[model samples]
Target: MIMRQGQQLLLPANPLFIWFSLIVAMMLNMLPVGRIPWMPDFLAVVIVFWSVHQPLRVGVVAAFLFGLAIDVHQASLLGQHALAYTTLSFFAITIHRRLLWFTVPSQALQVLPLFVAAHAIEIAIRMLAGGSYPGPTLLLAPVLEAALWPVVSVLLLLPQRRAPDPDENRPL
Candidate 1:
């Protein structure tokens, strides 16, 4: 939706939408695209977005819990995703205010490091547990997640972005 010059739409952010999107992201992560199971980390992207934009609604605990759910669902090492998500949330919370000052694309650029950090945590966990590297291809997930950031922001904000009033013609 385009806004005329000096026009701004300030729709209230609904907490429900935040929670619903997280659940959907979890389900999407579970879907198999191949035996590789290398889907973009949608949960991380969503958590970071909400943690940055709606900190009160989605926080470290939520990120930890969702990460645990993903861990269990994926049958991976316990607490791996949890640790990564919690750290990611912490970073998001710390950066949220600064993030608000930038445009979405710039925000995504800032967030790219967080996604990489999350993946680094995951890799470190695996290495500590004696699990072999999943290969260089594993690195692609974060890049894809970062690339999807702007798209996610736009889609998630659509509900909150009010369209210009069509009733401008109505009088007085």
Candidate 2:
């Protein structure tokens, strides 16, 4: 993979860090605050982030499992989030290489559609299962998630950005 000029090379992501971030995201989603219609899905954002950045380690299965956890937590349709997240991960993985070629903000713009599709899948499944419209504010969820892309990218990539061994004579 040819990196963009000026792009710092990131170290291999630790498996433990990957799973830890996923758990933290899940915990954030499980918070007691009522599920507001416009609130972004933190787990979805993290899942997509990892799927794009480390597809082999965090793929559709992880997304599906996390989605199921969220489904149970929210007491919504069993497969609603599972299917949505699975689709999101699949798409992110498919485009991961191409997506990495762009700047972070440009990548965010590219991923906006993926977020929209994920939320649309969730809403569609809900409506099919006889749930009422969650109102127009529901549209904000995907937009918010896309807006969070850069922040998520920076924070998650932080650990890998550090020098494995800092030495005055070496620059990496």
Candidate 3:
């Protein structure tokens, strides 16, 4: 089980990067993609990523607040996103340490159930409200989000990844 030099690279955690990533994800969620309401929930994805990596810094409270903001921003059922995100963050925080041991793609597989749980929360909320189901297409959002997890993981991890030692001998 020998690891390569750069494989275990880890850099200091930057709060700025964490907050900025969350804000950016929120903005992306609000982007106008008219008529297509099935856009993946960027906020959820980012929250999952941060919650898993920085659970102490980004916990259930942050997820709740962000979910509220999202609720207000989208003008949807207040607290719906909040509840979903809260639940999602809780699960992420709980399993974060275990997740870190796996590769990004494997991590995504582990998160699939959490994504499904979050979506189920949303559906439950709608059902309780007597709202019509958005159909099976609604379920696709979680799948799409899970698929994008690898990309999100890599992009977020890029800044924190250590560069190869410049003094190391070059292949000759």
Clashes (backbone N, CA, C under 3 Å), per candidate, total 0, 0, 0
Distance (Å) between predicted and true CA of 19, model 2? 0.4
21-137: candidate 1 lDDT, tens digit per residue: 999998988887754624689999999999998898899999999999989987889999999999999999999988877788898899999999999999899899998988888
Tens-place lDDT digits, model 3, residues 55-93? 999999999999999889878799999999999999999
Between prediction 2 and prediction 3, the one with superior TM-score is 2
lDDT of each: 0.88, 0.94, 0.87
- Quote the RMSD, in angstroms, for model 1: 3.7
Better of 2 and 3 by lDDT: 2
> Superposing all C-alpha atoms, what RMSD in Å does each candidate have to the true structure?
3.7, 0.8, 3.2
> Against the hidden reference, what TM-scores do the models get?
0.88, 0.98, 0.89
Top candidate when judged by lDDT against the true structure: 2
Those runs of model 2 whose alpha carbons end farther than 4 Å from true positions after fitting are none
